[model samples]
Target: MDLQLKDLKGIGPQMLHILRNNGIWKPYDLLLNIPKSYEDFSITSIEKWHHKETITCLGHITSELKLIRGYKKDRVHFQAKIYNHTIDIIVFGRNYLIKEFKKNDCVLIKGTYDLYKNSIVASTISRQDKQIEIKPHYRIEGIHDLKLTHIMKDLFESQTLPIYENLPKELLDERKLMSRREAFYQLHLPQTFEAIDEAKRRLKYEEAFFMHLNMKKDEKIETRAPKPYDIHQVRALIEKIPYTLTLDQKEAVNDIFRDFKKPFTFERLIQGDVGSGKTMVALLAAYAIVTAKEQVAVMAPTELLARQHYQYFKTYLKDVNIALLTRKTKDKDMMKHMIFSHQYDIVIGTHALIEEDVLFKQLGLVVIDEQHKFGVSTREKLIEKGKHKDVLYLTATPIPRTLAMLTYGYAKISLMKEKPKRREAILTKYITKQTIDDMYSMMHSALIRKEHIFLVVPAITSDKVTDNIETVYQEIIQEFPHAPIFMLHGKLSSDDQDRMMENFITTPGSILLSTTMIEVGIDIPTATLIGIYAAENFGLAQLHQLRGRVGRGNLASFCYLISTKEDVERLDMLVQSDDGFKLAEFDLIERGPGDFIGHLQSGYLDFKYLDILEDEEIFLTAKEDLEKIMNQPDFNSNPKYRYLYKTYTKQT
Candidate 1:
């Protein structure tokens, strides 16, 4: 069972290298490598095949597989007879398997039916007679699902691994759940769709149960008592402001206050779209904590954003002692001393705030802006600087439900749906080569109006960010020669970036061309135009964030998507709605939770079987069961709950 992957037959050096690259080290890992999805490759007759649709058919090779020299690489071209009809077979990247296909050999060919070419673009051609039933599909990049399936076939045929049931037998009987061993195997190789569903249900239950236990893992921590501050002071600061708070903003603030009044630590996420007045809500929350004589640490993802927060706080909370801490802080030691001495009421900075040298005297609240940018452990590290302090996470990117379920499992949630009344929606549109002239004319008018412009390009010459800004700079300069064009990219140093950004901000009618570096917290009120070239290359949340760069000011703004990918689902969703959260939900439905979190979220929720959105009932049941196990002392000895709890702890 613990044998290296090389023990499997037919897995030569190339296959072993591919498997190792994908993190598969041993035969036992095969059982743990659960399939994310299943594709139906059941052999079907050609009569029911649709054009351009994937179809699998049992066929006999009609001609010897011949290797033809392609312009780029050698190609394998063959003909197969299916249902007494001959069809061309084009096999790509599998020329090594040409020896396996003979003129009369029966094979199962699976791929899309190319009606125009009268061929089947072979995604996989299996010579084995065993029909590839509902085939397991791995979400791996280095190898195709069919090849992985074949590898698994060899591993199972060896029959050296002895699987064990992980779940307690009594609980399985009580819940009518499948055995863990059976569930694991069924996930990879199921006989029917119902079997897969049953297997998934069992795995999801265990995953959700463990997740609930992890959610309550912090219950053992000693929490600081809630300190209520006078609302009058906070109200005074709010009153000093020029405009009224929206209803949503008021509700979110009330929610935070309500959490602050609780005996337990307040961990709430104030999720909202860009320009949704979330900063003001966070400001009021910070003010209350400061009034309570507790220090606050506000963390941003980047120095630019940290400086923006520092400036924003200095303007609004003039009386509070606030310090900006970063790598280049003039008096770094002094700031750390002041923070440790409780002289600074509020400290806003980047990762510098979490440095070992930086200590808080009585850190009461941790305010993390753009929470997604930092890893979950990074947030934990910051919060640990003080005793179990209340946490306030601000994210302009809407929380996808899967993330909301996993990361926000135990935290209180407040949604800020409304932007301030003064901010106008940015008019977003997609442009093709034909409509590019109209877009240029529009940019010309915006420049003439004295407004600034932002142009983001996915410029790549050879590699290594070769003139990303310069390549686009040439064309943009030609279009608006009168306006000063500035370039910003990752290659620039911090000082250089600051200088360039300052120049662009101060100089009206100027343009800034760069990458997604300005994706978040770049405030330019006068900048009314943002052009995103190759918009299809970005994710939906990113495009939404880039689009948010505009429409910050009172004036109506425009976002030009310079791509012809109109049929792209994410692009269509972007065009349909200006709501960031809506786009996030759509992305979650399209790409799933893993794509949204990447590898930043690591823990029990580093998910394998979390269909949190679809299995909400299972999660609720797990939560209810968790309360029983936590409260009952007798359950500690009961093998079912006791062993399962042990399993949960072992994972953590």
Candidate 2:
């Protein structure tokens, strides 16, 4: 109500929604959202414009205007020929402008000139009185230009302008940073490119600082009331496991054991790649703590994963009581009784494990599988539940090297480079519709060899994807009518999914057609053939995981990436690179910032336009600024820092 950022006098609900979606709701939000690049249109002569130069022109339009209706609606355009140009000027989507031109005796247009057409098409056209107004245009969203222009125009004329001089002016001098008002003013209404450049530097630095500050704040909060447990007890338990832990895994386990022995709480992220044996490492950490006569809780992303963990724990630690806590268990009383009686030395489940009622008698360690699936608040809740205990987060999504250092700075890392002995490199191939028969022949051969199969669909039952599983299932049934097929998706009941997976796993001749849900925690040794339709549709990390599912078996498993030739070419880049870390980097560089980084990397931070690949130097600089601010709060308390702190705090 008090002239908030998007609350500019003329902005409506629709525009407000757009602004908020783009992380702009307050005046500071607008200020912080700086343009990536500027369009220079200061050239004034027709001769320079006719060089086919794309530049902005500011001038009053001659009274003459032309409205020509062509054969097509799209072709029907407004022609406003400039005073000096012989060629006609075409304005696309300018109905209102055409009507206004007819009614008005005066006009002005600002746009880029095209010499090939010998005309200057308007980027913006307004009356002479409004010609001096500054507008903010973005490549992705055109709405920002209108909203930002009105807001800046009003702010320049209003008394409610933000107090830029609030922060200590000396900090600006020391840091060689711009003033708060100057930064905002330049970003929205830059007189020169230098102003825009300075604004970007200031805003990026601020965003990075707040990110670091929040992390440190969370870390400080997590470390309160240090609790320590016996490390040898957990170690002794891990020592009994059959497989030898990798060096990185062993080191991470030892470091965690050392931290667990401390009186203070330990919260660390276990960074490992897919097939990195993260599960075993986590088991070791949990086993060590559990051996100390303390309870440990493990949470996975999906029911399949939870059940998988439960199966492993139940089988490996048959002597130790392991309780299953998930939504699927039939007997509620059994779950409650086992939990209350302390019959379970370790609890394994999904989100159910984090429920308010699932009490841990002595929650010594909390292990989260696929840590990115849970949001920050949810993870915080889990950490809070394990008061005075250690937190070991496991993620298969490969974290890029630079971001790993910044975001996971507090946590020690472990690598799972080596695959299990006898693990076959799943021969990955891409096929188009033309080669469908050949692909089918290959599947039949695998089946003849007594191998199982997994046919992965990209969508769920209810949630509409580009291509539906029902359609794919129909095609598969039609093509291979003799083979049995099972279906799994998010829409299916947990019981149904579990049953279907079991049936497919046991039934040698059956094929399991499922969403990416079948990617993790489902180990089918005989599943030698895996097929994913529209292969390029999924991210490289996910594609790798799905491929991993089939290759687990000793037999020479194959992943047939079924798609068009074009898609196959796109996917070939990933198919050639088996290194998850390298693939992750390639994926990051290719996709850029429009996609969610954390969602793929299991809780990685996705900064707007701050690509970890291209903007590594800037990322580091932002991180350094944040650390410096945290260490020197008094320095941030200065007036120059006030705008930044206020902007970031308001947004976060």
Candidate 3:
């Protein structure tokens, strides 16, 4: 079945636009948009209401609707006594509920019974008869609820939907996987909890299996000759360097060098914490590639990070011809020569280097920093440059085990467990507004010592919040009147962001006020003090990464999380601890990796009911199933496996 809707019999441009907006371009995708949860408002009476102390009710409005003036937009002032119960509902939201009200019609109202001023009040209200069953909500887009429901209803009712028959009948019978028709029908309209669970297990397993198969097949294809790369040279370079490589870096670099000597291509992911020497390992790999008389390239997710890496390499390899290819740095002809002519031995930049026009000069190795920030297509493009040369990926937030197996399980896995020796741990503190004066005084003393400071605000501009960059910049400038201050945010022009960063990088006793935009690459060793305002609003992994920015260069660094007392509870985990691993685990638990997937969430695996963090067991099982399926020569022969194939192909 064609993924494009133009191939569908009756899909017009208007409907196609709506479907595309909702990320439903194909029939298989529609099948995967499983209902998040069901809304059951079928209780007959208060006595029959499940006895759960709270329940949702949908019924006809038998009484007159009354409206009263609200004190605020959130405060609702309306009274309607339902037929079955004596409770009256009070709705709010600037009369948002009034639009839904149809005189003498049914409505769905949801709230717990509460006695207010001697009268019962149902706070949150909805339409009773209009309550949708098995509703699925995506991350909002140009599409709306009405649009999606209409499409889904049409697709369900239409026999024009081509049945996906990718799976073989024997496989479906062997594994007892549901058929294509049954799975699609049940997934959308699940009748029981058991059915939902089984369908999810089947779908998740199939996704992991397909991803693994592709990687395995890709790895199996031999791309380059076994170019002898001497580990001794890289080892000697490491030894001569002033700073010793961390144990993780040593092992990773060694593994990389050994793999480079192999006949097959090297595809590896280096999982390390922030401040761990991933860049050094990447440099060692690049050195090996250059020694082989082949070109090497390193791609960073951001221009700032790419420039930083280029500078690091340029300083270390004076003899090597290094070039930077970012949006700001390279001219068109220079970029073309760097790729087509292979003019530079090592080209470093962002996605601009991965274009079709960018050719390689005997491209031998590709290093991707912060690999999670990139998509599979981008990685594949970079890999294509190397003539099947080795690819090394470095990431601070190492893909979680379940995700790694789903995404890169077929590739080799290496862990960088420790930071460099004698590394000073970041001292983290959470301070309230009342204690901010004390915090400032301490920072002032640090500044008096001629030390640099980093002030991280939640926003670049003063919009949508009481505490913003403008407010924080003004307050900090006033407090440290003697010290210079600069600000940066994502919204600023790239030149402005770079200029501000450069100013802070060159000058001492200067406080750089910026947003989380600086979280990835800008490194200022002299900045011993980092003040993060509204820290509770940031996720734990992000908070850890931001804190990691200050603790670089073995100095005793401090990170201040300035928030209100009310916000302290939300940030207790950060103040009480400083382990990135533990923090990551906690972060995953608190926030279940919502939109970290490809396409920021949509094209990514958006698990409806499954929490990738909490349901670790399910993911582990999926991985095991994937491994089992990959080993089988003819997976199509298995009934269960065939069903999975059918579902996947239908969506793709």
Deviation from native of the Cα of residue 209 in model 1, angstroms:
1.6
- Compared with the true structure, model 3 gives a TM-score of 0.67
- Where does the lowest 10-residue lDDT sum fall in candidate 1? 459-468
> How do the candidates rank by TM-score, highest first?
1, 2, 3
lDDT of 3 by residue, 1-652 (tens): 3455665545678767877787877876766676655444444465544422455566566556655665554544444446544455556554655665755667666655553442334544555334454444443455554455556566767766766655445545655677666666666655565666677665654554454444444443475678776657766776777887777777887787778777888678887777777787788789878777788879999888999999999877777888888888647776677566866889898998888788886888888888777877788888887666777778787446656544554556677758777668888888877788867887888777667787787776656655788888778778777788888888788888888888888887778887788777766667788888887678787888888888787678888888754766657787787666777777766666653333331233444444556566755555565566657887656665765545434532
Per-residue accuracy of model 1 over 354-462 as CA lDDT, tens digit each: 8988999999899999887887668878989988688888888786544664665566778888888988888888886568887788888888888989988776343
Per-residue error (Å), model 3, residue 450: 2.3
Per-candidate alpha-carbon RMSD to the true structure = 7.4, 6.9, 9.0
Which 10 successive residues of model 2 have the least lDDT summed?
73-82
TM-score of each: 0.72, 0.71, 0.67
Identify the candidate with maximal TM-score: 1
In the range 1-652, model 2's lDDT, one tens digit per residue, is 4557544676678877877787787866655566655655344555555455454444444445566555653221344434444444456666565557653244455565666666666665555454443345654374746456667757766747664453345445766778767777787777777777786776655555556555654453244433344556555666687666667777777777677656566667777766667777777777766666777888888887888888887776767788777887778677866775677888888888767777766777888887778876677676677556778878777757566655554565665666665577778887876787877887888777767888887775445454468778888898889887888888888788888888877788778888888767777778788888877678787788788787765688788887753765558865686677777776777775336264533233657535566666666666665656646656457655666566545534
Q: What residue runs in model 3 are displaced by over 4 Å at the alpha carbon?
A: 1-222, 327-343, 355-357, 371-382, 404-413, 595-604, 608-611, 618-652
Alpha-carbon local distance difference test for all models:
0.81, 0.68, 0.69
> Is candidate 1 or 2 superior in TM-score?
1
Q: Regarding TM-score, does 1 or 3 come out ahead?
A: 1
Tell me how candidate 1 scores on lDDT.
0.81
Superposed by TM-score, candidate 3 places the C-alpha of residue 290 at a distance from the truth, in angstroms, of: 1.6
